[model samples]
Target: MKQWPFYCEQECEQYNVSSIYAPYLFDTSLLFFKAVSTALDLYGGNMSFYDIVTNGTLIAQCSVGELTGATDIKCCRHQMFVYNKTPVMGRTHDCYYNIGKKEMAYIRQLRMIDHENVNKLVGFCMDGPVLLSLWRYCSRGCLIEILTNDNLNINIDGFFIYSLIKDTVEGLYAIHRSPIEIHGNLSSKNCLVDERWQVKLSDYGFPFLKAYEQPKSSSEQLWTAPELLREPEAHPTKASDIYSLSIVMADLVNKNLSFENSDYNGGADEIIYLLKSKTSRLIRPVLEPVIEDFNIGFTHLIKDMWAEEPEQRPKIDVVRKIVKEMNVGKSKNLMDHMYSLLEDYAASLEQDIQGRTKELVEEKKKADILLSRLLPKAIAEKLKSGQQIQPEHFDLVTIFFSDVVSFTVLASKCSALQVINLMNGLYTIFDSVIDEHDVYKVETIGDAYLCVSGLPERNGNMHVKEIALMSLELLKKIPDFRIDHLPNEKIRIRIGMHTGSCVAGVVGLTMPRYCLFGDTVNTASRMESNGKPSHIHMSADANKLLTEKVGGFVTKSRGEVIIKGKGVMETYWLLGKQGEALLNVDE
Candidate 1:
């Protein structure tokens, strides 16, 4: 073999031990002497010093040491994961290097090490069927998985790019500062991402033991420094790690696989071959089409990072400083950036909700106004809330009934549309007059309108006064009211009211009517039917309530005429007011 080939190469090296033989990590340790003696005994012949080291795996097994007492791994079918309370992830690798004191101490040191950007090594299973190294599980996968997943749904802008690249750089920076000194394995795949997009570096250093554990795949070799590929026995230096970081940066910047748009068309193997073979034109990932839009400083810095010569690349500290400068006024944490985005979204959503709420309120007001016409407001509210409204009895409420006099004769002279227009016009005036007093307009049947007070919402003794005023005002509006179709004819209404105890309720499911029941409503209708045109007729009870209980009105006696239902009931004429002359309905 021309060069000593190892999977991870001399990634973990002690600089002071270079003066000693370069073939093994621990030449001074007792395990190294024992291994050498064992190797010499097995060979049983004279061999050159160069020949032993040049044999690659032979010298490696003879030179490196191993820690003893590796217990067997057990598996119970029923209680397999009963003691696995701590969160951990296990991985297997090729059995090549043994665990010496140095490798054992390396594992302990890694277990002790804790950093935000580093994944902690928990323990390992060496004596098991396979070499299993456990680590804390990262929920979100590596960088490539995040970038390639079509359903991630995250909008990758400059800030997103900044956050990911920033995290990777920070992880590399931490490793460089750690006791391990250099991250031997620095690839996008080795960089595990979390839910918040934090990047943590895993599987680094301890090159001797790791040499045969993880053999390099062609894709994994894409991030390797060209010089490391050229020299088979070379160690992965800080500069080489920086080279790996540059490849990852390119992956983030371009938002694709490493060297995805490179000139090598023959796939990963061809690209690795090209990377080793130096040509006039350098073989590196191009910044490409979006390079102009990137920060000028970042673009130049990135190019410097991937320079062909190892010494030409900037230090990790310098790279960190420049990256920090690029993010001067920006958020350091991705979670903070996402929170800012959420706040902005919430503000806009709140405005939209407020607009919808305003429109709902306006529409509800319109519906309530229309509903008040159909039933009393209290009753309508009860029905709206799915509450059944029981029939309510008012001890003393005034009921008013009115009709357009000779309505049949008038309607017979006109078409249906004209009759409707006439009634609408007449009621429009009466409705306007009724609004001034406290009364609920119940229902209108043809030309007859029934209005009442002190039932759904009661008022003390003022119902008779309200009814009396409303009746007079309605009759007063009759002379001025004109029919649109018959302009010359004046509209007259015969009004009758009775004050007595009666029951009021919503009577039906479809097109509900707020109807009044008992003799008071009937007597009031009879009074209106028996009334003269252009006057308000009142029952004895209503006249008594108006004149005595609530004295505010003027009335005229329509002497003892036998009522149809009740015999010999004396009624009265509701004239204008106490101050005005009585309205002459006798004409």
Candidate 2:
């Protein structure tokens, strides 16, 4: 691009010597690239489009990168700077540049000077020996100042001295009507009210005064008009200046200056600036007059102003006309005018109702997503619909239970988020295996998961073999879990399965759940709790069913064992894939 001096000289030629001046302040000690780089990294990118001039030489510049590289861009600087030959405490916090341009200087300047129609012009440093002008700072901060200030508790009056508003408009008119439009970086900082309630526009940092051709590639083009945003960009034209002013008008009408906190903006460059430009002028009139001294309406106006399309906006003169006509002075009269002006209030109210309804639908979708994460979608949906899913009593359901070994202790080793991801990962493996077989998942209680086949509806003789195969697959897949948060723990699942008569039905009124009863469920849970990791335990009936017909598993009879409340029962361990060397079934 074109160098600084060439551009400056060109600007001087076009706007006369009064609008342009060459830098004379010089001190190499004060001119360090570190300070400039800090500023660039902080505010440099799109918002940092301005140049850092110190002394008689240009030290460095900050420019936002292209869109593709935006996310990787970290625009923060922590370099130190020397002001008044003394070290300033922190690096220049620059990210607030674009939207907070005027406010940065205005805030400090307001405290230093009391001025009407002139935002407090505090001193600014050029990252070198020389100092430049900065807009003033106000003691009470900006409009949001009193709103959020805990100690002050000052109630904001919307009237804000109409004369002050008029003066701010006059200053705006002067800036826009100038030979070259002066785009006041009109942030809350740049807007100030002296003790006398006089309003002034401060901080001319981003304004293009007089006329000068832009660089072959202009960095500011991102927020500029599309024609100016192209390569070999057009000069910063009057229309662009008007576009920026529209944003300033919007700030006044909306009360608050920044749109950063708004969720609607979504980081779209052209759209953000455009929305800021439209403000109160575009607000549905039916809703406007009813807005009391202070309410969410001001925030709503800010959103409408900065809408994506600039052409859909009203002109400044037209905006001025609306504001003037709506100056009904009295609150009751304003409310009366609200009914007759613009569209009907009922329609706007209906729109709000529709918007809320849409939001509720989205919330339900998200809740369903979260629920699906916790339980299988089929079961989760059935539960949500409030269906009485009665438990199935069957003579042949294959019940399976698996528990994460020492899950409670492992949970203590990790963060809440880490534990959740780890748990989900383990369950996901089990879920995948279950889906391959003819089985339906019951529910997960803590770290334990339950599943059944052969009722609700039965898949016949395959239920026992299917559950056994699923358990084997689960054991084979166990070691894949490697959670950084729990390095010492290897995720191991202990499984237990049973095949016999059991009554299954939905239980409870408030938290209605489908569960199995009788010895089958109790035996299955006992098998998991008592079994070793990577091993599957089965009741005598389950073993007999699998070994007699399937004939693949190596079964080891563990003799009669006492099961809670059911007395001594015979059980066997299926030790390996079927037909491999048996694990001494009688031993």
Write one digit per residue (lDDT tens) for candidate 2, span 254-294: 44433333344334453434433555543111222222564
| lDDT, each prediction | 0.76, 0.55
Residue pairs with colliding backbones in model 1 are 67-99
| Best prediction by TM-score | 1
Please give the lDDT score at residue 103 for candidate 1. Answer: 83
Candidate topping lDDT:
1
TM-scores for candidates 1 onward, in order: 0.51, 0.37
How does model 1 score by TM-score? Answer: 0.51
